[model samples]
Target: MQNIGKIVVVAAATLSLAACGQGAKTQAAAPAGPPVPPSSAAPAPQSKGRECAADDIKTTGKFGEKPTITIPDDCDPPKKLITKDLSEGTGNGAKAGQKLQMNYHLVTWSNKQVLDSSFDSKPFELNLGAGEVIPGWDQGLAGIKQGGRRLLIIPPDLAYGQGGRGIEPNETLVFVTDAVSVPAG
Candidate 1:
């Protein structure tokens, strides 16, 4: 009986660690968007894939599935954050301290394996400048308008660094995102 009890405790502990993104992620809260007020103006079209025109990474996927990414096998990570606009938007751009709903795809630069993507599930909500996400996100996401799509190529220093979640230590990360909404403060 004592041996069984120990086994159960160890199993529970391991499960707990895995639940914390084992270095992956947490289940995001339900999707929420800006409260739209009825108007006569037609809504602007949302941006989609156009990755290769802007950066070295290439991606293929629709709005609701995991995207496939292709990067040059020998390409090196840039020293600074690379924010490439895939498409433009007319809505208010994201800013610090505002709540935002965004669709994102994250892949590690080392092995080119996808780590996370909102396109697989509900759009992720982030409180800008709140430290809920990595520093690269807060800095790279700034100035992008709602309805815009962008590519953020974040170097290892701006990402998980040595204490990597599921990612390798000091891994650079690549993210393609659509700035869906920024609700009023």
Candidate 2:
């Protein structure tokens, strides 16, 4: 056993019981304490963002169901991404550079049609700021605790911009997500 501060590393010999050899475990055994080189410690994750201020965008419907979005006529989305946590989670908060799994639903600003949904498939895995997803999702979901439900309103710049993936040009996107896990740093 190794101790750093109050942490204890309970090192044990892991045995392979299967005939077929497995390559390796994805997750590493966490160190008993902080990194030996304190300078190498990862920076803390950004806290959950503030609630949306765009009065034009409104949501009406229960969670875990197809959400209904109401967009006021001639209304524009906020320049910055707006985020709101509908329900608190029960897991740890994530840090920068860490990967996470989430279930999400996305819709266009003009028409409230669901462009994509993870509810029909598996949870989407992404590393924070790793450029696997849109900037809004990366910035908005940062530091979000696991199992938490959050809503994000992303502007065109943060979304697809002039050329959208499946929607119109310069379209703003709305996302509702469930942060399933936020591993310890």
Candidate 3:
């Protein structure tokens, strides 16, 4: 009976961790002009495959607002994690162990569909490098300054290895994150 209880606890913990990504959706085409409103439909698939690099992924919009992320159709996944600062922030840089409050937009590279976002609701909070989130977030977010906006291109190993609840297996991830606050440490 005690062993069964322990198994249940472990299963519950695993489920909670895998809940990071909500669901799977296909990629879409990029919007032409201003950022697309939240009500816009998903983009259509394109033929060209863009290399997995910061230069190829386009982000538009001011910091602290919901930005537009346009991933090339059939984007080749990177072998490792890539972090690029779209806008630099002042003050101390973020390090492991410090708590961070942030708003982010996440999309899967394979389908270019939005997997999750904190812009419409409350900001997401996490302790850096504490295994509270995916390995990509832990490895990619280090040294980002408060108030800065960054782009993280994460391959499968850094994200969900075998995939999770809603994420497809071995799917690459693209994120646009704004550091809402990271207390001085």
Regions of candidate 1 where Cα sits further than 4 Å from its true position: 1-54, 61-66
RMSD of 2: 20.8
Candidate closer to the true structure by TM-score (higher is better), 1 or 2: 1
- Compute each candidate's TM-score over C-alphas: 0.65, 0.63, 0.72
Once fitted onto the true fold, the runs of candidate 2 whose alpha carbons sit more than 4 angstroms away are 1-56, 60-66
> Which candidate gets the maximum lDDT versus the true structure?
3
**Candidate 1 has what TM-score?**
0.65
- What is the alpha-carbon lDDT of model 2 when measured against the actual structure? 0.70
Q: Residue by residue across 1-185, what tens digits does model 3's lDDT show? A: 99999999999988876764332211234334444436675454443555667888999987898988998644566778999999998789999999999899999887788989999998899999999999999988899888899999998898887778698766889999999998886
lDDT (C-alpha, whole model) for all candidates: 0.75, 0.70, 0.85
- TM-score for candidate 2, residues paired by index: 0.63
Model 1 Cα lDDT, one tens digit per residue, 1-185: 99999999999998988877544543344434433436974454233333223357787754334557676654466667888877776677788898888899988876678888888678899988888999999999988887777788887788887645787655778888888786642
Q: Count the backbone clashes (under 3 Å) in each candidate.
A: 3, 0, 5
Model 1, poorest ten-residue lDDT window?
45-54
Judged by whole-model lDDT over C-alpha atoms, candidate 3 comes out at 0.85
- lDDT tens readout by residue for model 2, 90-159: 6666666999988888888656678888878888899988888888888889878887778889988888
